[model samples]
Target: MIPKKLASSLLIVALALPGCGLVLENRIERREAAAEAAYPSEGRFVEVAGRRVHYVQEGRGPDLVLIHGASGSTRDFTAGFMERLTDRYRVTAFDRPGLGYSDNVSEAYEGPFNTRSASPAEQAAMLHRAAGMIGIENPIVMGHSYGGAVAMAWGLRHDPAALVIVSGATQPWPGDLGLLYNVTGSSLGGAALVPLLTAFAPEAQVERTIASIFEPQEPPPGYEAHIGAALSLRRASFRTNARQVTGLRPHVTAMSRDYPALRLPVEIVHGTADTIVPIDVHSRPLARQIPGARLTELPGIGHMPHHVSAGAVVAAIDRAARQAGLR
Candidate 1:
C-alpha cells in the first residue's frame, strides 16, 4: 500500500504543475498586451519567403542599411542611429527574422529547441530579397554585434556597396558561452523556462541586462522603455534568439574563410574595453584579413558603441560612402 504522506506529496506536485501552467498562460497574455503597448511597430513590412520582414526606412541620400544585434530590433536604430544618420543618408533598418515584428520561419523542432532559419546566411538572404522588394540596391550595409555576421553574409551573397562592422561577432571565440546561454538555449530549458521568464521576469532584471550590455556607460534616459525589453522575452523571440546564438559559431567559422577575398571597402569599429566581442579576437584580426579595411579602436568604450559613439560610427559610414563613391 502507498504511504499517505508520499501520496499526498505526489498529489500536490501534480496539482501545482498544472496550476503553474495556468498562471504562466495568463501572464503571457498580459505581457504580450504590455509589449505591444510599449513598442508598437512604427515601420512597414515586405514579404520574403513567406515571412514578413519589418523595416523602417527614412532620410534621403545614398542608400544605407542597418542590421541590429541579437535580441534587438529596428528600434535599436531608432533609439539613436536612425535619426542621426537619416540627415545624410537614406537609412533603412531591419528586424532580423524571428525577432521584433518580423515573422519567424515555421519549422517543427526535432529536439526540444532549434531552428533551420536562425543562421546569419539565411537571415541575410531573407533581408536581401526584402531590400530588392523595397527598391534598395547596392546600398552600404552596417551591422552591429550578431548583425555584423549577417552583414558579412550579405556582402558575400549580394555585394553591398560597403560593409561597416561595429562590435561584430566576426570570428569564432574561444570556449562556450557559459551557463546562462547554455541553460536558456537548451531544449528542455527553453521549453520549460522560457515561458516562465516571458511571464514573470521583472522589469528590473531587464534593466540590469541592458545596463550590463552597455557597461562603462549607462543607458540614456527612457532607453529601457524605448528599446522594448519585453519584446525580447516573448516566448518565440526567446527560443529563436537562443537557437541563433547557440548555433552562431559554426556559421562564423565558414564566413571568416571568405573574408580575405572580400574587396569591398570594409570599416571595422570596436571598443578596446568590449568584453562581449573582444577586440583582439574579432575586429583586429578581421581588419587585417580584408584588404584595405580600416579599423577604428575607441578607448574605454564598450559593446554598444553605436549608441555610445554615434559620431564615430557615422564618420566610418561617410568614409565607406566616399570609398564606394556613393557621395
Candidate 2:
C-alpha cells in the first residue's frame, strides 16, 4: 500500500547508511595514523602473555614504578615528572594496557561492540609480570588517578615495597561517572559513536579538557605537546579507556575491604581543589583505611599535583622509601 516515492526514499536512505559508515571508518583510520605519527612510542616494550606493554625506564638507584591515570600513557610521567626522580631512584613509567603503545589485555576486548575491560587486578598482574621480566624486585609502586587503583591492586596482590597514590581514585565514589563515560562505555555507543568521535573530535576540545583537569591551576608550558592527548583518541584506546573507567567502581569497592590487610609503606598526596577525584572522597578515606599511611593535602591544587606540586609528590615518595627502608 506504500506510495512509490516513499519506498524510493526509504531505499535511498538505507543505501546511503552503509556508505556513510564506510566514510566514517576511513576517517577514523586516517586520524589514528596522524596521531601515531605525531606521537610515536618513546619507550621500549616487554611481551607478557603474548601482549606487549610499553614502558620508559630511567635512573639507577632503588627501583620505582609509575602508573598513569585513565586516558594516559607513560608520557604523562616523562613529560617532566620522571626527571625530578631520576636522580634519586631508578624509575620505570608504564603505559597501562590498551592506552599509549600497549596492547589491549585481550584481543576480545578490542572489538568495537565489546564493553568488557581488564580489571585492576588483571592489569596489576600483567604489569607485575613485565616488571619481573625487567628484573625489578620489591620496587616502590606509584599510581596517579586511575593508575592509583591499579597500584592498590599491586600492593594487595603483589609484593611492592611501598605505594604512593597521587590524586588516586582508590575508593568508590557515591555517584555515576556521568554521560561521557556512561554513553561511550555502552555497546551501542562503542559500536556506532566511537568512530565518529575518533574522526571528528577537535584538538581544541582536547586542550580544553586538559586545561580543566588542571583547573585552579594551568598546565605548564609545553605540557600539552609533551602529553600527546590525541593518542587516546584512537578507536580501540578510546573504547577500552571508557569501558575501564565506567566499570571501575565495582572493582574498587571490592578492593577497599582488603586495604586494612596491607602492610606496605603507603603515602597519599591529593589536592584539596581537585575536582576529578576529590580529596575528601578518595585520598582522605584512603589514608584512613591503611595502617600508618601518610596523607599530604595540597591546598589550591587540582588533579595534577604531581605536575603543579611536584616537590610534594617527590617528598612523599622519599618518605615512602624511607618507611620501606629503601632510602
Candidate 3:
C-alpha cells in the first residue's frame, strides 16, 4: 500500500514533469506549428556565399532584423515580433545556417556539429550578408537567446539604429542544471539520449510540456494540436544544439569583454524569474557593460516574456527604438 504522504508527493512530482519540458523547450515550440500559422510570411531563399538561406519579409518602415536563437528559425521573429510590428516597420527574419530551411555552410561541419555556425561571430556575419542581399541596410537587429550573441556581433561591425537582446544568453552565468539539460545541451554529452527519448517520449509528455511552458497562461484552444507539431520539427536541431553547448557557451564568455565596444544604443529585457539564461548573465551585466545600455526586468516573468507578457515586450522594443531616436 502507498503511504499517504509518499503517494501525495509522488503524484505532485508526476504532474510536474510535463510542465518542466515545455518551459525548457520554448525555442522549440516557437519554431513549430505556431510559426506555420504565420503563412505567406513565406519562404524566400537567397544565395549567400553559395549557401541557401531562408528568410521571411513583412510590412514596411525602417528595416528590423530579427534573429532566432539556437535550434530555431525566422519563425520565432515572425511570430513573436514581426507580426506585431509590421504596421510600423519592415521586418525580416531568417533561418540561421544549419537550422530550418537554411542550408549548411559545409555539408561537412568540422570537429563539432551544431544548429548554429561555428562561432556567434560567424553567424552574425552570415546574417549581415543575408540582410544586404535583401536590401536591408543598417537595420535594427534584434536577437534572442543564442541569437543575442549574433546581434551583438553584427552591431559591432555595422552602425545600426539600435540593438535589442531578449532573454538573451549574453554571458555564461552560474546555475544548477539538471542531468537531463546537460545531456540535451552539452557537446559530446551523449548520443543515445535523443534516440531513446524520441523513441519513447509519449504524446501525454508533449502535452504536459506545453502546459508547463505557458504555466499560468492557461493553455488556449487547439493548444494540444500545437504540441504535436513541435515534435515533428526534426531532432537535428536538438541534437546539434545539444553539442553546441560548449561551443556557444565559450563564445558568451568572450563576448562579455566586447560589449563595451558597441556604441549603438542598446536595450536588454530579462525576466526576474527566468530559469534559463539567467537574468544576471544578460540584462544586468550587459546593461553595465554597454556604456549607455538600458535593462528592463519583468517581475515574476520567465524567459519568454513575449508569451507571458506580450504588451511589455512590445513596449520594450518601442522604448528602445525611441531611446535610440528610431521613433
Candidate 4:
C-alpha cells in the first residue's frame, strides 16, 4: 500500500520541477569513466525508426540481442556483461524507442514510441528490423521485464537461436500508475521518495532506484550520476516512463493470449520477491501454458536480476544458450 503522507509529500515535490528533467552533468561524468573502463570503445550507432540508436556488440559467434525494460536503455545491461561473453557469442544491446539516445517520440498518444513502441508486437518487429539493419541473421534474442515481452513476441513469430529472459514477463503486463505519476513528478519528488522506496540512505535515492536495474542493491559509487544524466540530458526518459504506464497495459493483455502458441527453446527467469510486475501476473502462467517452457525462480532476487544478481543471471543466460546449443 502506498503511504498517504508520503504520496502527498512527493506530490509537493512534484510541484517543483522545471520539467521532469533530473540533473545530467553528474551522470555523464560517470558513464564516460565507467563504460570505457568496462569494455574497449567499440560502441556502434545506427539509424532505426527515423532516429539514431546506440548499441554495443562484442565477441564473434552467433548473435545475441538484449532488450531492456521500461524507461530503460541498453545501458541498463552494461558492457561488462558483454565482456564475459566476449570469447564466444556476439552480444548486442540497444536503447529502446524513447529511452537513451533513441528517437524521442514519447509524446502522449503520438506516433512511434507512443503506443506503437509500447506494444510488444510493434517493438518486437522493430527490434527485428534493427537486427536486420545490423546484419545479424537468426540472432538469439533475450529481454528483461517489458523488454521480455517484446522479445517473446519476436521469438514467437520467428525462430531465434534461443530466448533468454531475466525476470522477463512472458505473458501480459500490468503497470502501477501511482508509481507512474510519481515518476512524472518533478525531480525533487523522485529524489526525496526514492530513499523511501529502496530504504537506502536518503540522498539521491530516486536516481539509485532507476540505476538499480544495472547495479541493484549495491550501486557503484558514481552510478547515481548516470541516473541524473538519463533524467536530465535525455528529454524522453520520463515521458517514455509515463507512456509505458498509460499505454502498454492493454498490449500486455493482448500478448497474454499468445502464450499457448509460444514455440521456441525458451528459458524464463524471475525473482519471487519482485514488487514490480509480480511473477503471478504473467510469468508463472506463461511458464505453465507454454508447451515446453522452463521456469527458474530465484528465491531472493528482484525484477532486475541481471543487474541485481549478475552472476546468477549470467549463469542462467549461459544455461539457456547452451540449451539452444550455442556452445
- Number of clashes in every candidate structure? 0, 0, 1, 2
Question: Candidate 4 regions off by >4 Å?
Answer: 1-42, 104-117, 173-176, 182-203, 208-216, 220-233
lDDT of 1 by residue, 1-327 (tens): 112343344334434576577766887889988898878897999988677999999999999999999899988889876898888898999999889998875454223455433678888988999999999978999999999999999998899999999999989989997655665577755666566667767777678789988988888777777899788888788778878888899999999999999999899999998998899999999999999999999999999988988889999999999999999
Ten-residue stretch with the least lDDT total in model 3: 1-10
Ten residues in a row with the worst lDDT in model 4? 193-202
The Cα error of candidate 4 at residue 88, in Å, is: 1.1
For residue 268, give model 1's deviation from the true position in Å: 0.5
**2 against 3, candidate with superior lDDT:** 2
Considering TM-score, where higher is better, how would the candidates rank from best to worst? 2, 1, 3, 4
Maximum-TM-score candidate: 2
lDDT per residue for candidate 4 within 203-261, as digits (tens), equals 45445455455432565455444433333222244445545545566776776677778
Error of 2 at 170 (Å): 0.7
Error of 4 at 152 (Å): 1.3
Q: In angstroms, what RMSD does candidate 4 have relative to the true structure?
A: 6.4
Best by lDDT: 2
- Return the lDDT, model 1, position 290: 94
Candidate 3 residues 1-327, lDDT tens each? 112343344334434565556553564345544534543235699888888888988898878888877656665554445668888878888877666666655555422223333577777777788789889976887887778877887877667789988888878767544455454444432233443343334556556655655444545455344223242234454455444444576787887887888887787887887766778666788898899888888888776676567677677778777877778
Better of 1 and 3 by lDDT: 1
Pairs that collide in candidate 4 are 27-225, 27-226
lDDT of each: 0.84, 0.90, 0.65, 0.62
Show where candidate 1 strays beyond 4 Å. 1-19, 106-112, 115-117
User: Model 4 clash tally?
Assistant: 2
